[model samples]
Target: MAELNGSPVSLEDLQTLALTNYGHFTSMRVDDGVIRGLSLHMERLVRDSRLVFGAELDPEKVLGYVRQAVAHQSGSFNIRITVFDPALEMGHPGVEAHPQVLVTSRPTGAMPPPPLKAKTFSFSRDLAVVKHMGLFGQLHLRRKAQLAGYDDAIFVESDGRVSEGGTWNLGFVDEAGTVVWPDAPVLPGVTMQLLQQAHEQTTTAPVTLADLPRMRAAFATNTSIGVRSISKIDAVEFDSDDPVLDTLRKAYAGLPDERL
Candidate 1:
């Protein structure tokens, strides 16, 4: 399903996003009319709208549209809310902005995805802190990784510091079982934030590719999959069934869901 400002989205308006690609979005999994980290998703929309469009977006208004879009849907599904301005042209992007909300939904995939084997690629996203629509570089690397016999790609900085995954945040378990989040400039994922808030043994540190061998376990975090184990990164392997991974997943699943 696709909706724009509570109405069906038109292909003419979608052309703007397809060509310019100057926008931001947030994706979340909704189940039974409720969503986890709904407030965080709203916060991200408001924040990114201001930064990318130089316009103010009301979270309550966005919520109203979201409620309308999900009204007829049942069971579990994934919803993506994209903020963009169809009237804004590429020639005069600096003009005053009027952002529009585009809501799209898709079927949710299997839960607790199978462990992933990621190949490390030397690349970083522009404005990595914002979840913008600039995904060419990341997707390109992911394709290259897949063609090379890996499940996915993990980004690494030029200085050898490990950053993030194609579309998720990466976390590691140290020898002592502490959850260590990479100290790199990556998008602050809502699921990762919720896990950090609920998990007691957590810390932030700079992780390099060379540091992977010292870690005992690793996992990927995103709204769709929650927490999924990473069995390998490059040549280093981790315990996919580590007890710490189970604890982290439970902690995230325990977070209370908010009504949409």
Candidate 2:
């Protein structure tokens, strides 16, 4: 289901986002009536709106629209809140903007997705900090990886530093059991932030594909899939059932949820 500003969304309401694709969005998993990292999600939306559209977005108004969209739904589901202005056209997008909220929901997938076997690609998204609507580059790499018999793709910079997966943040467990987050220009995912807060032994450092062999295990984090183990990346196999992965998963799941 989809709604625009607390009402049903029509084709006209989505034209700008569909055609221009000049907006930012946040995806969250809503369970019952609560959400994990709801505040962080809203903060991302508001912050990205200002950076992408040059306008301020009311967090409370966006939250209200989300609550209204999910109020009737039951059980756990995934929701994406997109902020865009229909009045803004591609020719003159710099004008003062009044953004609107578009909330869409879908059924949640299996928790802890299957272990992923990813291939590395030399690609990085534009505006890596903001979760903007542009996805052609990310998805294209993912498709190429899949066609080559891989589950997904992990982006590596030309300088050989690992950044992130196509749609998630990458995390590593060193031999000493420290959780190492890649220090590169990537989207600050809410789940990754929560894991950093909950996991006591965590640090940020530049991780290269050469450094993967020294690591004990690796995993990916995102809202839909809380923590998923990475079985392999470009032939460097990791123990998908590693004990450290289990600990990280439990740590993330233990985080407190906020009421929507």
Judging by TM-score against the true structure, name the best candidate. Answer: 1
lDDT of model 2, residue 97: 87
Q: What does candidate 2's lDDT look like per residue over 155-232, in tens digits?
A: 998888999999999999999989999999899999999998998999999999889999989999999999999999
Superposed Cα deviation of residue 118, candidate 2 (Å): 0.5
TM-scores, all candidates, are: 0.99, 0.98
Residue 80, candidate 2: how far off, in angstroms?
0.5
Candidate 1 per-residue lDDT, tens place, 42-65, comes to 999999998998899999998888
Choose the strongest candidate by lDDT.
Answer: 1
RMSD of each: 0.7, 0.9
Backbone collision tally, model 1:
0
Q: Which parts of model 2 are misplaced by more than 4 Å?
A: none
